[model samples]
Every structure is written in C-alpha cells, then in structure tokens.
Target chain A: MPVITYRQALNDALAEELERDGNVFLMGEEVAEYNGAYKITEGLWKRFGDKRVIDTPISEAGFIGLGVGAAMMGLRPVMELMFWSFAYVAYDQIINNAGCVRYMSGGLINCPLVIRGPANGGTNVGATHSHTPENFLANTPGLKVVCPATPADAKGLMKAAIRDNDPVCVMENTLLYGDQGEVPEGDYVIPIGVADVKREGTDVSLIAHGRAVLTCLAAAHRLHEEFNISAEVVDLRSIRPLDEQTVLDSVRKTHRAVLVDENKPFCGVSSQIATMIQEHAFDDLDAPVQRVCSLDAPAIYSPALETQQLPTADRIIQKVLAIS
Target chain B: MSVTRAEKPKKTGKNPVDYAKAPINADLTPEQKLGFLADMLRIRRFEQASLKLYQQGKMGGFLHLYIGQESVAVGTLALMGENDHAITAYRDHGHALVVGMSMNECMAELLGKATGCSKGKGGSMHFFAPDKNFWGGHGIVAGQTPLGLGIAFALKYKGLKGCCLTYLGDGAVNQGVFHESLNIAALWDVPVVYIIENNQYSMGTSLARSSAIKSCLAERATGYDMDWDIVNGENLYEVRAKTWDAMQRAHEKCRPAILEIDTYRYYGHSVADANAKKYRKPEEIEFYKQNHDPITLWENRLKEEGIADEAVIKKLDDAAKKEAAASVQFAEDSPFPELESVFDDIYYEVDMGTESGKTGRHFFND
Candidate 1:
C-alpha cells in the first residue's frame, strides 16, 4: 500500500488502464495539452500520446454522443465533462443516447462509456458549475453512477468503470482532489455497486457519500468523544447499483440512521435511501431515519453562506443527535 | 404527364437541377444497378405495407414513412465499404432496408413482436443492425449526428479506411446538436459525410420557414471549413455520383463532407400528423410524384440504358410486393415479447450475470 493524493490515484488508474487496453482512450476538453481542467489527467497525454489521449473542442453534446457511438462500436471511451454542470448542454446525449442505446438496440449494442468529472460545490464555483447529478444520472436504469469518497475508492472505481460492459458515470469531488489516503499498488478495482463501512460502531449508523462521507467520519469521531454515541459511518461508494444489503445491515445493527449528502434535499439520493430504509427495514429501526442534505437552494457564491449550505460535521452531528 | 407551375415554381427545398447526366462509377455493373432499383423498390413496398397495417391498428406508437426518399438511402449506401456505417433520424425505414435489415424483422418490430429486430423494445423509429454497420433509428432530431461522428472517429482510431454517412432531415439541420457535430467532424478531420436529406418540410413547417440560409442547407458547412455540395436525390445515378465523391474524400484523406440531397417526402411527417394533406396542395404532391418519383426515375433510367425492360421492371416490382406481403404475415404470426424481457438489455453485465450484476440488485425493486 502507498499513501497518495486522490488526484494521483486517479491519474495512476487512467495511465494503467490506458497501457492495459488498446481500445481504452481518453477524450475531453483540455485533457491532452492542458493536462486537464482539474489536472487529474496531468501526464497522460505525454504518456499515451495524442492519438490515445484526445482533446475535444468545447462541445459537450457532440463529444459525449461521439463517445457513446464509439463505445457501441466496441471501443471503450472515457469522456470527461469539464464540469459535470456543463453536462446540461449534452443532457440528451447522456440520458437518451448513452443511457438507452443498449436497451433500444435490444442486446445488439453495448455502450461501454464512462463520463467522469468533478461534481461538488465547496469550491465557491457558483451555482452553475457545482452540481451533484449522481441522483439524476442514477435515475436512468441503463446508467451506473458512483461517487468515490477517498483516494483508494477513486482509483478502484475508475478502473472498474472502464472495465464494465455498460455505461458508468463516475462522479468525482474537486474538494477531495488533494486529500491523501492509502491506495493499493496494482490492478485494484472496486465493484460498481458496493458500500464501504468507513468505521464500525454500535449506537447509530451515519450514511453518506463523496465529500459527505468525510463529514460523517468527522461527525462520528466527535460523537464518540463527546456524546459517547458510537456512530457507524457507511460510505456509499456506488449509487445506482446500490448495495441495499450493506445499508440495511448497518441500519439493522445500529437501529438508528442519519443520511448526509451534498445533493439538494428535495428528491435527492437520500430520499430514495430513506424510503428504502422505511419500507424494508422499518421494524429494525429504533427511531425514524433522519437526513442532512444541502439546502434546497442553488449553490450560493458566498464562501461563508456556501459552507453552511452544504452538509457539514456540525449538521451531521445535529442530525445524528436528533435520530439517536 | 407534365403540369405547369401556377407561380414561379415556389422556392422549395427541391433543387430543380438535374445531375443525372453526371457519370456514375465505371465499375458499377448492370446487375449492381438493377440491385439498386430493387433496394429502392423494397423500401417503397415495405413502407406501403407498414402504412396499411398502421392504418389498420396492427402497430403501436408512431410510423414515419420513407416513401419518396428511397434513392437518397439506396444510392448512398450502395457506395459503402465493409467498414462504412450509416445512421439517421426517426424516419429510418429506408436506411434500415438499404443496410440489409430483413423486412420480416423490421415489420415485426413495427408490430411489437418478439421476433422484431429490437425484440419489440424499439419500434419503427429505433431499428438497428450493428452487424450491417447501421447504427440506429434515433428518435430525437439530429441526435444521431454525433453518434455518426463517433463511429467515424472509432473507424479512424482503429486504422480502418471507412466513413460514416450521418443522415439528418431538413428539420434536423435547425437543431443545435447538428452544428456541434459538424464543428467537431471538421475540427478532428474525422471521416464522416453528413447527408442532409432536405425533404422540403420539417413536419408541418417548410424548410424555407424553418431554416434560414442563402442558397442551400449544406452551405452552412462552409462556416466549419468543410467541403459541401447539393445533389438531386431524385435520380439514382446522380445520387451515386455525388455521394461517391464525398465517400472517396473521407476514405482517402479521412476528412469530413456535407452532402445535402435535395429530396421530398410524399406522406405526412408521421402517421399521426392528421393535416399531412392540408398543409400542402394536391398539385404540389402530384408534380413530384409524376416527375421526380425516385422509383419511376430509376426504372426509366434502367430502360434507357438497356439494363432492363418493362417486363424486367414488372418482375422486380412483383417480387418486392410479394416479399412485403410475406413480412406482414410473419409479423402477424409473431408473439409479443414476454413481460420478463422488460428487464432485459438494460445492462450487459446484468444480463450476463457478471460479478457486478450478481453481487447487487440492478433494478430498484429487487
């Protein structure tokens, strides 16, 4: 194991996959000569050369659709949306062309495409650039959505998405780009639909994903030190092919649950998780499942207001206290 | 059979210029020319049968007929190599038939039968034959343009000397995605030929009302620095002449081109368009039917070139009619897809029972 930043982990996974498969190529804006908009693809262009690592014009709709077409033709294309919010211009291509191609073609076509980029709001990029669309993308049946909360999950999930035979969307966080964690050396891949219990506890379960996972971990530590509430932190690494069993097991053990997420409160991923908990594990609960989500407003530009807008350790602790 | 125009022959999308005198490929054999006629007739006859069934309530959803634009598909697809591909908008029966989809599968698909090309998931507007290099019958206008560009990008990536002929309609040219596709195709020099089948009307709106351009729709390609031209889609020989040249530039130089084939549609935009005849006059439809009908033009050319006679043409038409009729019977005999199949094909890993599929529940209900 080696300690590395999430950015380095993602770059290493991409470089390894590019060397492993000839059909796997990277295409996006500023991914080649500019390294990357976020610098996640720093040295891939010089390593894989211009042919394998392609730089697309500022045409999200065109390039995303092109990636779907190429994937249908048996080439695995990892398309980068400079900002996940920019995906709105290409929403039709993502939802219809990439999501429905396989189902529409009735097993004759396979869109083995991966659309990955930073989808977070903590950087004060304004309301437009900050969008957590994991819920929106996972709503489509043909698409697989994942949000890696750590450096290890980032590397493993990126590799798995590239190897999957279906369209997978990797939702990354810019806030956690420089965060350091242990990453396995080689050929490591996390399955598309699995959850990781970040810490084990007995009193209550704190469920979260992406940056919210870190928030839950911080909340868990404070809850243990101050309130003596042993909070189990469940990191939902994959969203679509959701690991219901793991989530249900954690709730069934802890008996109380609090969901933390950066997505908006209305009809967010937590809404689905709450319904699932109430329906399947209602009898196992000692209290009602509570949620701490981003306020139902657009991501504000003000740094002070924006930090309060997203889920934080204080918010998670408060939600856990109410539930436990 | 000629009728005089009441006005100065309304400035419609149809180009009155005739390129039939343009020389076709020298290597094109007489049998190949006859095959072209057969392919066009097959599409026309298949569409006629599908329309009759649609009117009879045998099919569900929409049916967009490709009755008058047969030559655009046949002549262009006739020039495709083993690696070349074709994709089009919702009006896709012509491209599907030209790309070797069996009439039985296509008809059954329209009828929502299990034996259909898409196993009854995709109806008339979503036929696909990846084995034959036909990408799809995309529903959204201009949605397939970028997909076609990507297919060409893949071919170039694999070092294959082939091009993708991306087809869109007059209405589709107004969509923003089509422009985006054109810019990328030219910027990357991907081997793609965007064939704008300008059928005069975009649903109820005419091209003159929907698209604003100086001379022709393909002229917009100049903005992207891409080579482009307009060809008469009525004459099969001329369609081949122009499309052949564009295909060559794509294959040899790996460049992109735009060929706007001046064509017309005889029926409404779809079967559901109740005012198909109300928007346009009867004289306008009759004029194109008599003078520029793709089938009639190709049959006349075959006779003039001594490639076929009246009897030969009648025999080909009879066989096509018979084939279309048999397809109807096959569709009638087919079964609807099973309810469980509704969950199928959503994910390849789920169907294959791979590690990811077996580990967790793909469907939410599970």
Candidate 2:
C-alpha cells in the first residue's frame, strides 16, 4: 500500500493508460502546456509528447465531439472538461452523440471515451462554474457515470473507465483532489458499480458517493461517538450501475437509512436512493427513510449561502437522529 | 419634406468572389464516368422510392429526401479511401448509399425494421456503418460538425493516410460549433474536408434569410485561416475535381479545407412538411428539378462524353428503379426486433470478477 493524493492517483491512471495503450490519448484545453487547468495532467505532456497529450482550444463542443468521433474510429480518447458546468456547451455531443451513438448504431460503433473533470458546487465558483451533473448524465441510458470518494477508487475507476468499451463520465470533486488516501502500488483496478462499506454498524445505514461520502462517514463517526449509535456507511462509487443489492442489504441490517448527496433535492441521487430503500427494504426499516440533500436552489456565490445550500455533517446527523 | 443624412460607405471584404477552383482530373476514364452516373441514379431512385413509401404510410418518423443533392454526396464520397471516415446531417441517405451502404439496409432503417444498418433502433436520421467508415446520420442542425473534426483528429492520431469528409448544410454555417470546429481543425491541422451542401435552405427558411452573408459560404473559412473552394454541386465533374483537390491537401499536407457545393433540394424539408410551397414557390422547385437536377446533369454529361448513350442510360435507370423496388420489399419483409432486444447494445459488456468469487459482466439488462 502507498499513500497518495486523489489527484496523483488520477494522474497515475492516465499515465499508465497512455503508456499501456498507444491508442489512448488525452486532449483538452490547457492539458498539454498548461499542465491542465487543475494540474491533474502535470508532466504528462513531457512524458507522452504532443501527439498523445494534446492541448485543445477553449471549445468544449469542438474537442468533445472530436473525442466522440475519434472513439468511433477505434481510438480511445480521454477528454477533460475544465468545469463540468461547461458541458452545457457540448451537451449535444455528450448526450446525443457520445451517449446514444452506440445504441443508435446498433452496436456497430463504440465510443470508448472517458470525460473527466471536477463537478462539485461548494467552491464558491458560482452557478456557471460549479455543477454536479451525475444525475443528469446518469439519467442517460448508454452512459456510465462514476464518482470516486478516495484515491484508490479514483485511480482504479479511471483505469476501468478508459478500458471500458463505452462512454464513461468520471466526476471528480475539486475539494477532494488534495485529500490523501492509501492506494495500491501498481496494476490495481477497482471495478465500477461496486459499493464499499466504509464502516459497519447496526443502528442505521448512511449511504452516499463522491464528496458526500466523506460527509456521511463523518456523520457516522459523530453518531457513534456522541450518542453510542452504530451507523453503516455505504459508498456507491458508480452512479449508473447502482449496486442496489449492497444498499438493500445494508438497510435491511440497520433497519434505518439516510441518503446524503450534494446535488439539489429534486430528482437527485439521494431521492433515487431513498426510493430504492423504500421499495426494497420497506418492511425491514424501523423508521421512514430520510434524505439530506442540498436545498432546492441554484448555488449562491456567498460563502455562508453556499455552505447553507450544501449538505453538511450536522444536517446528516440531524436527519439520522430524526429518523432513528 | 424630410431631409436624409449622408449614408455611410458600404464595407468591403465581406464577400470574396475570386475563390480558388480545382482542375478536373484529366484522365477520368469511361468506366469512371459510367460508375459516377450509376451512383447518382441509384441515390435518386432510392430517395424517390423512400418518398413514396412514406406517403403510403409504410415508413414512420421524419423522412428527409436527398432528392436533388445527389452529386454532392456521390462526387465527394467517391474520392474517399476505404479507411476514410464520413459524417453528415439528417439529409444522409444519399451519403450512406454513396459510401457503399446497401440500398436494402438504408431502406430498412428508414422503415424502422430490425434488419436496418442500425438494427432499427435508429430511424432515418441515425444511420451508421462504422465498419464501412460511415459515422452517422445525425439529426441535429450543425451537430455533426464537431464530430467530423474529432474523426479527423483520430485519423491524424493514428497516423492514418485518410481524411474525414464532414458534410453540413448552408444553414449549419451559422452554428457556433461549426466555427469552433473549423478553427480547431485548422489550428491542429486535422485531416478533414468541411463540405457545406448549400441547398439554399435551412428547413423552411431560405439561406439568405437565415445567414448574414449569403454569397460565398466558403469565404467564412478565411476567419479560420483555412483554404476553401466553391463548386457547382449539380455537376459531378466539378464536385469531383474540387473534392479531389481538398482530399489531396488533407492526406498529403495534413491540412483541413472547406468546400462549398452550390446545390438544391427539390422536396420540402421533411415528408411531414407538405407546405414547402408556402416557403418557396412551386415554380422555383420545378426550375431546380428541371435545370439543376444532379442526376439528370450527370446523365447528360455521360452522354455528351460519348461514354453512355440513351440505351445505356436507360439500362442504368431501369436497373436503379428495379433495385429501389427490391429494397422496399426487403424492408417490408424484415421483422421488427424482439422485445428483449430493447435492452441490448446500450452498453458493451466487460468482464469484472465479482467480490463473491464469480465472474460477472456489466450490460444493460443484467
């Protein structure tokens, strides 16, 4: 085991994939000379040269479409969007072309592309710059959306995504990039659509993914330390192929559940998870399922308003206490 | 009485008429001439049958006929190598046919039969044959422009001696993605030829009403610092000549170019819109049908070159009509897909060993 930051894990995955397959290339604005806007692709241009690690103009529709088209021709392209919100500029390319090309082509073509970037709202980057589009992207039938909460999962899921024979969106949080976690040394990959139980408990199950997983884990710890209550934390790393069995089994054991997510409450991931709990493990639940999500409003720019808009550990704790 | 102020001077350089023209390949043989004529006729007949099928309520969804814009697809696609890729807007049946997609598959797709090129999942607007390097029949206006640039990037990335022929309509030139794609294609020198099929209309509105500058769509390439040429799309010889020059630059120099083909569409935008007469007069449609029809133009050229006579032309036309009828039969006879197949091909499967010590693969249904 080796300790590394989440950003390093991502870089390692990209470097390894580019080295492992000549067909795999990385392209995005500022990815080559600027070392990536977030510095996730630092030093990769020097290692792989200009052909593999490409710098593109600030045109999301142009580059993303290029990735989709290239993927149709049997080349694997890893495209990066500076901000997930900017995906609106290329929404047709992602949703219509990248997502449906395979199914539309009757499987004659496979868009083996990985579009990865930060997609969280808590950095005070305002409404346009911040977005958690997992719900929007996951709603698409042909796309696989993965949101990793740790360094190990980030590295493993990114590698899996690049190798997967379909378009996959890797949603990374800017806040979690510098966080350190234990990652395996080399040649390790964690399969997408698998849930990991960070802490086992019997009182209630706190289920989450991405940055919200960290919030759930903190709330679970607080519940145990403050009230002598046990809580199970389930991390759903993949959004599309949701590991429903793991979620149901955890809820059945705990008999109480709280779904935490950073996205808005209306039709968000937490709403979906709460529905799953009520549908599958309703009889086993000791209390009604609770959902802790961001308030139903566009993300405000003020620091206090932004914090109030997002879900926090206190909110999760409050939801668990009320349900339990 | 009112007095008017002096008018400001009109700006220059907005429209450049002195565009470059490519010479026709001098040694085009009789065999090539006949082949070109046959390809154009096949497209014309196929579209004619497709229109009739839609009218008979056999085919559903939007039916966009490439009735008059045959030579643009036939001439441009004729020059592509086996590995070269192509993508276009919704008016795509002609391009698909010229790229070697079977008339039966194209008709089946238009009829929404499971035996279609896209397995019937995608209707007329989504035809694709990746095996043959035909990318798609995208429905969105100007949506295929960026995808075309991406295909060109792939060709360059793989060091392939092939270019991507991305076709858009005159109306698509106004889209932001089209400008962005052209800029990047030139900056990166991606091997792509941006072909604007100037059929004079974007759906119901004419190009003059929709576009700000309507004279030379190829001149827009100047902003991207790219080479561009305009050709008479109705004449197969001019289209082939100009496209050959563009493809040569793409393959040999790894450069991108824009080609504007002056063409027309005889029918309404789609079969559902029978009000084509509301936008453009019937007389104008008849004029293009009689004077600028690509199929008739090519047929006349073949006869004038002493390569094909009236009998030979009649034989080719009869064969095309017969093939179009057979394609309809193929589409009508083909069965709809199984109910379970709705979940198939959504996501390709990959084996991922499970935590329970069993091998499992990820797919749509499972």
Candidate 3:
C-alpha cells in the first residue's frame, strides 16, 4: 500500500485513464496551461500534450455539451468544472443532454463522460461558489453520482467513472482534496454504489458520504473514547445507486442511526438516508433516527458563519449521543 | 487628449453592408430535381398522417408537424455523408425522415409503441437514431446547439471527414447557449453547420416580435467571426446548393458556419394548438400553403423542365400516401414495452459490489 493525497489520487486516475485509452481526453477552463484552478490536473497537460489535455474557454454549457456529443460519437471525454456550483450555468447540458441522451436514444448512444470537480461548502467561497449538488444530480435517473470520502475510493471511482459507458458525475470536495490516505499500487477500482464501514460498532451507526464521512469517523472515535459507546461509520461512496442494503444492515446491527451530510437538511441526502432507514429498519431501531446536516440557509461568506453553517464532528457526536 | 464627460459619441444609422444578399444557385438535373420533390412529398404525407392520427386520439403528448419547413431539412441533409451526424430541436420529424430513419420506427415512437426509434422511451419531441447519425429530437429550445458542436468536435478529434449538422428554430437564436455554442465552435474551429430553420413563428409569437434584430438572423454570426448565409428555404435548389457549400467548408476546412433558412410552418406550434386563428389570420396560413409550399414548388419545377408529367407526379404522390399509411399501421401493430423493462437501461452496469465481495456487473439485458 502507498499513501497519496486525494488530489494525487484523482490526478493518478486521470493520468492512468488517459494513458490507457487515447480517446479519453480531459477538457475544462484553466485545466491545461493553468494546471487547473485547484491544481488537481497539474502536469497532465505536459504529459498528454494539447489534444488530450484540452483547455476550454470559460463556458460550462458549451464544453460540457461538447463532451456529451463527443461521448455519443465514441469518444470518452472527462470534463471538469471549476466548481460544481458552476454546473448551474450548464444544467440543461448536464441534466437534459448528458443525463437523458442514452435513454432518449433508445440505448443507441451512451455518454461515457465524467464531469468532475470540487462540490462542497467549507472553503468560505460564498454561496455562489459553494454548493453540494450531489443530491440534485442524483435526482436525475440517467446519471450516476459518486462522492468518494478517501483517496483510495477517489482513485478507484474516478477510473470506474471514466470506464463506465454511461455518464457519471464525480463529486469532489475542496477540503478533502489535501487529505492523505493509503491507496493500493496496481490497477484497482472500488465499484460505485457501495458503502465502506470505516469503524464497526454495536451501539449506533453514523452513515455519511463525501466529506461528511470524515466527520462521522471522528464522531465515532470520540463516542468510543469518551462515552464508552461503539459507533459504526458507514461511508456511502456513491450517492445515486445508493448502497441502501449496506446502510440498512448497519442500522439493523446497531439499532440506532444518525444520517450526516454537508448539504442542507430539507430534501437533502441525509433526509433520503433517514427515510430509508426508518422505512426498512424501523422495528430494529432502538431510538428515532437522527440527522446531522448543514443549516437550511444560503452559505454565508464570513469564516465563522460558514463554519457554523456546515456540519462538523461535534454535530455528528451530538446526534449520536441523542439517539444512543 | 482626454475626452470630457459631456462629449458623447454620435449615433449612426444601421449599416447597409449588414444586409448581405443571399446566393442563388438553381442548377439541378431532372433526376436530382425529382428526388428532392419525392423527399419533400414523403415528409408532407407523413406529417399529414400524423396530424390525422392525433385527431383520432391514437397518440398522446405534443405533436409538432413539420408541414411547411420540408425544404430546410430535405435540402440541408442531402449533403450529409454516411458518417456525418445531425441534431435538431422539437421540429424534428422532417429531419429524422431526411436522415434516413424509417417511417415505421418514427411513427411507432410518435405512437409510444415498443418498436419506436427510441424504444418507446422518447416520444415525438425526443426521437433519436444514433445508428443513422441522427442524434435526437430535443424538446428544449436551442438545447441541441451545444450537443451538435460537441459532435463536430468529436469528428475532428477522431480525424473523421464529416461535419455535424445542427438545426435550431428562429426563436432558439435568442437563447444564451446558442451564442455560447457559436463562440466555442468558432474558437476551436469545430466542423459544424448550424442551420437556423426560421419558420416565421417560434411557437405562437412571430419572429418579428421575438427577435431583437429585425433584418436577418444570419448577421448574428458576424459577432462570432464566422461565415453566414441566408437561403430561400422554400426553393429546394437554393437550400440544397447553399447547404452543400457550407457543409463542404465544415468538412474541408474544419470551419463552423451558420445558415439561416427562411421557411414557415403551416400548422400551429403543436397539434394541441389547433385554433391557430387566435395568433395569425387564416389567410396568412393559406397564403404560405398556396404560394410557398416546398413540395409544390419543386413539383412545378420538375413539370416545367419536362422531368415529370402529371402521371409520374400522381404516381409519386400515391406512393408517398401509401408509405405513410403503412407506417401508421406498423405503429398501431407494435406492442408496448414490458413492465419490467422500465427499470432496465437506466445504467449500463448495475450491482456494483464492494472490494470485500466479488460481486459481478449486472448488465440490463443479462
């Protein structure tokens, strides 16, 4: 096993996929010469040259739709957005074109496309730049939404997304990009829509995805150390074809659950998880299911306000304690 | 020299050079002329049958008849190679027929039967046949513009010698994505021919009321530094010749260009809006039908040139009607998709198992 940062894992996956398939090309604003706004695509342009590592104009709708069209024409295009929040400008392309093309085409065409970039709040970049759109994208039937919480999962899922015949949205977080974790050396892929139980416990299950998985793990550690309570942390690496059976099995084992998400509470990812648990494992639960989510309001620009608005380890611990 | 705050730039009148005259090239052999006439008549007959079926409650959802805009699709698509691709907005039945989609599959799609081009998933507004290189029948206005550009980008990327012909309505010109697509297409030199089928009215509102610039929609291409030309869409020869030139430029030079085809729609926006009298006068519809019908114009030309006599024209008309009725019968005979199939095709591979377990991929058909 080798340790690598989450950004490096993404870069490695992209580099490997580009090397493996000549048709797989990366395009986005500031991705080529600028080394990406976040530098996740750093040194790829130098490695692959201009044709494969294409730097597009600052037009999300234009380039994303182009990627979908290319995918239809038998080319695998990996398109990047500066931030997932910018996807709003190109929502019609992503939601209408890429998401519905295969179904609309009667399976005659498949958009083997990956639209990846950072998609979380914690950066103090204000409401416009900060958006967790996994819930919104997951709502679309033709799309696969994956949010990996670890470097290994990021690397594996990115490769899987590129290889999949359908369109897959890879939702990354800015805060988690720098976090380092153990990743396998050879060609590996953690399949999408599978949950990883980071910590095993019998008291309660803390289910989360993406960055919220980190908060859940931290909360699980504190629950065991301070309160003598063993909390299970289930990382839902993929959101769309959500691993419902795994979450239900975890809930059935612990008989208590807390759904944690960085997205707002109303009609959010946490809400969906909590509903699933209550619907499937109600009789097995010892207490009511709790949710730790961001406040239902626009993310403020101020550092303190933003920090208070998002979910944290303290919030997950409190939810766990409440249902324990 | 610094200018004062009160010094204002002088306003000038519209430039005369902005109004460039459209090119005219009406040179066609007797065989080619007859082919164009037959193509336009087939679409006309298909649209006529579709209109009748909707009235009899055989189909559900919106039915947009490509009645008057036949030449735009038939002429432009005549230049496409087998490898070339095309995409268009909701006014797409004509384009599908022109791109060689069988009338049986298209009618089945309209009827929501399992044997449709889209397997009963996409209805009239979303018809697609990628095998024929017809990308789709997009519902959202101007939605296919960027997708078309992407297809062209792929053609260039793969080193293919074909262009992507993307069609939009007159109203789609107002959409922001349409402009965005043009800017990128010109910037990257993507091989695409963006054909604006200006069918007089976008839905109910006429082009005069909807468009900001009154003179010509092709002039908008100048802003993006791309070549543009307007064509008499009702004239088969003019439409075909101009589009042929544009498509050649796209294929040979990898240049993106715009072609604004002046055409009209005889019916209302959709079949649902039968009372088109509310928007426009009956005489206006009658005027275009009588004077500017693309099928009639080509038929008269063939007769004048002694290419087709009354009997030959009658035989073609009879064959078109027969084929259209057969398509309707095929649609009515096709069965609906199975209930279990609704969950299929959502993903190419499902059942993605974790690293701890060796769960195999679950393909839909498997």
lDDT of 3 by residue, B1-366 (tens): 112223312212112221112342334456776777788889999989988999999889999989988988888887779668899999889999988898999999989889999888889998887888889899899889999999999999999989999999898999988899999999989999999988878888887899888657877898898988876777777676678778888989999998888888988899898677788999988988888888887777678778898898888889989999999999999999888767655565542223421222222121
Q: Which sections of candidate 2 miss by over 4 Å?
A: B1-24, B350-366
Better of 1 and 2 by DockQ: 1
DockQ of each: 0.81, 0.58, 0.49
Cα deviation at A292, candidate 1, in Å, is: 0.8
Top-TM-score structure, candidate number: 1
Docking class of 3: medium
List clashing residue pairs in candidate 3. none
lDDT at residue B87 of model 3 (Cα atoms): 96
For every model shown, what is its TM-score relative to the native structure?
A: 0.97, 0.94, 0.94
TM-score, candidate 2, is 0.94
Ranking by DockQ: 1, 2, 3
lDDT per residue (tens digit) for residues A85-134 in model 3: 99999999999999887777777777789999999998898999999999
Output the lDDT of residue B89, model 1. 89
lDDT of 1 by residue, A15-59 (tens): 999999999999999999999999999999998999999999899
Candidate 3 chain A minimal-lDDT segment of 10 residues? A101-110
Any residue pairs clashing in model 2, and if so which? A66-B150
